[model samples]
Target: MKPIRIVCGTRESRQDFSTKTALGRSLLIHEAANPVDLMLFAENKQGLSSIYNRAIDEAKEDPAILVFVHDDVHLCDFSWSERLREAVETFDVIGLAGNTRRLAGQPAWAFVDDRFTWDEKRYLSGIVGHGSSFPCNVSNFGPVPQACKLLDGLFLAADSERLWEANVRFDEQFEFHFYDMDFCRSAELGGLSMGTWPLSVVHESGGAFGTPMWRESYRRYQAKYAEGGEPTPQETSVQKQTPVHQFHNPDLLKLMPTNAKRVVEIGCSSGALAREYKKLNPDVHYIGIEIDPSYAQLAREHCDRVLDMNIETVSAQLLAEDLAADCWVFGDVLEHLYDPWQLLQKIREASAPGSCVVACIPNAQHWSVQARLSVGDFRYEDSGLFDRTHIRWFTLVTMLELFTQAGLTVEAGVPRVFDEPQRERFLPAIHAMAAAAGRDPEMAVQDALPLQYVFRAVVS
Candidate 1:
């Protein structure tokens, strides 16, 4: 590891003067022993190309890790060098700040390297530039795993050698916006990994320009990424499909007939999904049965009818007589059951002939999860495929078999997209566990199984 180099890109405009002052104050307060260099470019100073050119030139003679900081950010941590060095060693790209909301024009911290491939997107951690440790812990911040994408240009560190080798410098095109995206895209293309660590730094939003200019910059960014040829059509398509709701399969609703007269949802916590079905097809009367009283109350609030009884203890005959549903929904509920097979049997006995059974289950065999487990990292949490409450895990084959054994047939099934950071984090580990259990990680990874499975079956 070499001495960390800090570069601040500033403009000569009046707006930039404040940013320069803030950076100057941060340097003096932190008393950084290493020589910190500052570069001020005009507001229209030929975009970020000039800044990168100067940085490359500075590092050309003596190569070192370059830590780029924006004017609005302040360095709270004195030992940022050490933590940044560690992150740079582990991840190809390291981001310093975390944002609660996704800022326009800024890249979201998504996608991390799992050795084999990148995992889900994530958020950076810490105060933007306040003097906290490089791996500083801030409240409400989660794991900034080395596999996530770099978010924001507030603060970041990267190896000079690797960056130059990949020719992945920030793109100066479009003046200001999309520089981060261009750089990240180039890094991904160049086979470099990216992530954020628990580095704390404070950042004042829109330091360089006022809100108006910031909005303009974001507009340009959106236009470039949206219309520009930089992000390939496939990349754009993938990005378009990257919304949060895209993770759930809308087709799962298709499992139920449009004119389904009666429907039952098992383990309907909150009845959110059941309510959605009811809204979509109002003609289909919906009934939700929940074991938890608290959640049952929530379901009752949202759903038409709620059964506040545990599926395991309830009598099949009584449940069947209570509401003869044409369809049964097991959306993300089976895995949490103490005995999924027993519940399935009960449902089978209760269901009418040709009644549709829809189920969703998370694949325990995603690739990223496999990589984590292969490296000996298995921490149990409250939820996910390895949720502490989960007594059973299922892959595609086993899930299908479970349904088939219960006298049901699969009609349509597809992997749902998993684009969220939290869910993506567990994927590698799940896949690893599945592989160790001699299961196919690829099939398990496919259909983005809701860390629980979603299945649609017909009761024979």
Candidate 2:
């Protein structure tokens, strides 16, 4: 059996390898257990594909299971080499974690679309550990040794002879991001079998996803692949699963005044928020304005009055009938309007002093949106920051401006954020961009963190 030849690249020099890096330290300890050939690129400035291609070319004659892995990963499994030896015999290309299907606009192996949406768990496979130590949190995607169309680039293994024979090589244009996806696509096209395997490895860094660099690489990937192809099976599946957006936001409810008796909600789909609020204030008269007659009918069960007409078409006199409402809630509704500024002015006319206007608006400055913008992917989704119905977008600054300009006194604004490990990794890139543009890194990070904002404004 051919021995496992490990190929990895690192920013750390050879002198600091064992002491400073996870891969270096792991190799030192594991080399004694299972001997293997190592090709380490220290202080590397070149792209990963360039580095891997060099290794592949160098090992053209020597038939061995070539493993291309990242420097931040620690080889934890004692029998990892033996596992790879067996895995290669079964599949032409092997990885630790991957998706069984691939979509047309997929930006990553695990994600189904450019929105960074994770493919369903059933279509996913493999489990990988994360963190600095051996006993780390495991992300169990699904069962391993399953057939996959795409594989994570963090740890990939293949026989050199097979790769050389198939004439499959990584595209050099992708310096960092999407290289794995591109490689898997190339391998699949070349008729090489790819699948995931059960391997124990702790990766320290969760990938930097929503960074400027990653987005630029994504554009290149899209240009190379999304040229001329019929809708894939994955794409068809995603299209069939159009997301439903009818959930109520608790943050918006919390922003409403407690002493208020009258409440009016805009675009109140099925009056979900009205139903929740009525539970708290039974005496509160809840009026819902819904364009859809079906939703208006459903909302009548929860709300005191349901207007089966568009708020845009409703006269100011009709709006003033519910005058002095304690709260006018627009939960994720303002952006859908053609003229939100005009509507705010009308709401101002209807409101009395101390009356609160609470709204939950999606932030256009969020890092995910920025990443999509960078890659030129403005494709609208059924629901999300990129909701197809959204006609306008706002940042925190502009949102405040909208309130203040419409004769409403801004009281407080709270951010709704969901922090992920990948999002945290994106901060360094944001900081670098901030420095280049002479902007405050702290403020830049602050602007990028929030997915949306819930603001409370009073008619002062």
Candidate 3:
């Protein structure tokens, strides 16, 4: 077996190596145990591609297996060198984690869309540990040692000869982001085989996702790989359809009364919230009301009862006689309703006195809406604040009025604000406008910040 040469870029210098860095410490420990076939190389004050390319070129003379890894990764498996050796026998290139398939506009290895939504677990492979310390919590994506189209660049290994022969090198144009993606695509185009391998590694950083710098890198990536082909009819139809209902609203779950016995959730999508909340209070009788029969069928596995009918059409007398719910949850459902005010009134009338109402509603006064409106771009999207299905909109003030008019006393409200960099100029402009309108500028800016509001209310 060829010797494994580990190549990584770090901000830390030689003198301050093992004490400050995760990779340095892991190397110090692993090298102590298995120093025979392992070699280490490091570069500081350079972009990742430059360092990796330099290492790849140098490996031509040495003719060793080159492993490119992030400086924040801690290699937990002592037998990793042997694993890499075995992996390269079958695959020319190997990674610790990867996706079996790649989408046209994939922003990341594990993600299928620009929304940063993860690809289905079925198409994913490999286990990864994450934390700031050594004993990390493992996230098992799926069974590994499988062939993959895209691999996570956090830890990648390949025989230097294979890369040199295939003429596959990290695209120097991509400094930090998309380099791995570019390299993987280039290798596949070059007819080099790729697969994921079982290796224990802990990555410290969660990544700078949604940051301005990351977004800029994504723009450059799209520009470089942008193709002229349009989506097929089937693909267009798939894209237009709403995503599967699997996400649980954390804010709604948090607002739920801890001791509530019976809970009725309006627009329960796949019983995700019920499934999650059931872990806390196992004996709670949960009922889900969903218009989609398929979603209701899925919800039946989690909830005590699943009502496959629209809330707007359900009679108040039937709701009061059957449900008698102590807690009612509406997670991002009110805005989609033709008349949420009437629905909430019916809920208040149907539920027990002092019964809790936990709801998550999108705020129309978010700066993104104002920013887009200024440019006459109020275009509806497949999802988000301007979802095409949304029939009504509400700001914080209007939302409060919504509950009050429904005879629900507002107990608490939590604003969900992302404080994105784009809001820097928009917020100040909003404050100025508020002042001109004789409203308190500080309070007005506060109202404009949150993209959504979560409220905990009770029947009065």
Best by TM-score: 2
Among all windows of 10 consecutive residues in model 1, the one with the lowest summed lDDT is: 237-246
Q: How many backbone clashes does candidate 3 have?
A: 0
Q: After superposition, how far is residue 434 of candidate 2 from its true place, in Å?
A: 71
Worst 10 residues of 3 by lDDT: 227-236
Q: Tell me the TM-score of each prediction against the true structure.
A: 0.41, 0.51, 0.50
In model 3, the clashing pairs are none
Pitting candidate 2 against candidate 3, the one with the higher TM-score is 2
Superior candidate under TM-score, 1 versus 3: 3
lDDT per residue (tens digit) for residues 1-460 in model 1: 4656767666557464543555555666765553554445546356665586578667867788887767656666677566777788798777754332222233333222112122222333433333323443333345554354345566667878888775666656535554665566456435566676776566555334334654465555555433221332222222111111213346567666777887877767766676567677877667777655456567775566665444554445444755467887776767766577876777788777888788777777555445557788877665665555555777767898888887778877766655666656666666675599897776555634444445677877
Off by over 4 Å in 1: 1-251, 419-453
lDDT-superior candidate, 1 or 3: 3
> What tens digits encode model 3's per-residue C-alpha lDDT throughout 241-278?
23457888788788998788988898787899999999
Q: Per-residue CA lDDT of candidate 2, range 1-460, in tens?
A: 6768888888999788877888888888888787888888999999999999988898787777889999898888887788888898899999999987665667788875656778889989998889998568999999989988799999999999999877788889987888898899768645578999998888999999978999888877766543212334323432211132456788988888866788888878778888889878888978786655556667877887765444564446545653336788998889976678988888898777888899999999888887778779999888888887677999998999999889999898899988556777677777788889998988988899999999999888
lDDT of 2 at 298: 78
Predictions in order: lDDT:
0.60, 0.81, 0.80
